[model samples]
Target: MISLNMLSLSLILFSISAAVFLLRRNMFIMLMALELGLNSAGMAAAHFALTNSQTEPVIWALLFFAIAAAEAAIGLALLIMISRKFSTLNSDEIKELKG
Candidate 1:
């Protein structure tokens, strides 16, 4: 059914998140990976809602979607601050204590 494909797509998205978060040294890319993981989780919840023929899961997914949006906004704000302070988006370079 459609739910099955959605679940499979969620799994693939999580895998992509893992790879991007682990392999990339850029902070923006890492933030994108985090968003991907969040989206995949939302998709999985939607899949469950569809399979169960219920509205509660769908509502919960909507709430999660809102939270994800807020998280993205906060994350982008932080990204701006970090880039301004560190002058670089590289994860390794951003770690230095510039005292």
Candidate 2:
């Protein structure tokens, strides 16, 4: 059963994630927001699946969760490499890629 409170909480999380991803300068926090958005989306999908009695959305949500985990791992690795080289996690300050 999908409660109204769960829906509201998911909506709030999605909105906060969007705000953090768009308005924040720190790469680490932006990555965190990205994960938050992924999880909220997964929650919404699961809720929808439960309300509709469908298995597809639940599977899709699981896929999203897997992708979120991969994204977090890769993002953290990149963040680590970048921070070691630049000494900061600010997206604006970390520009200029070197090949």
In terms of TM-score, the best-performing candidate is 1
Q: Tell me the tens digit of each residue's lDDT in model 1 across 1-99.
A: 888999999999999999999999998999999889888988988999999998888887888789889989999999999999888899887656666
The TM-scores, one per candidate, come to 0.90, 0.89
Off by over 4 Å in 1: 97-99
Candidate 2 ranges beyond 4 A from true positions: 97-99
Q: Residues 1-99, candidate 2, lDDT per residue (tens digit)? A: 345667778899999999999999999999999999999998888788877889998999999989998999999999999999999998888769768
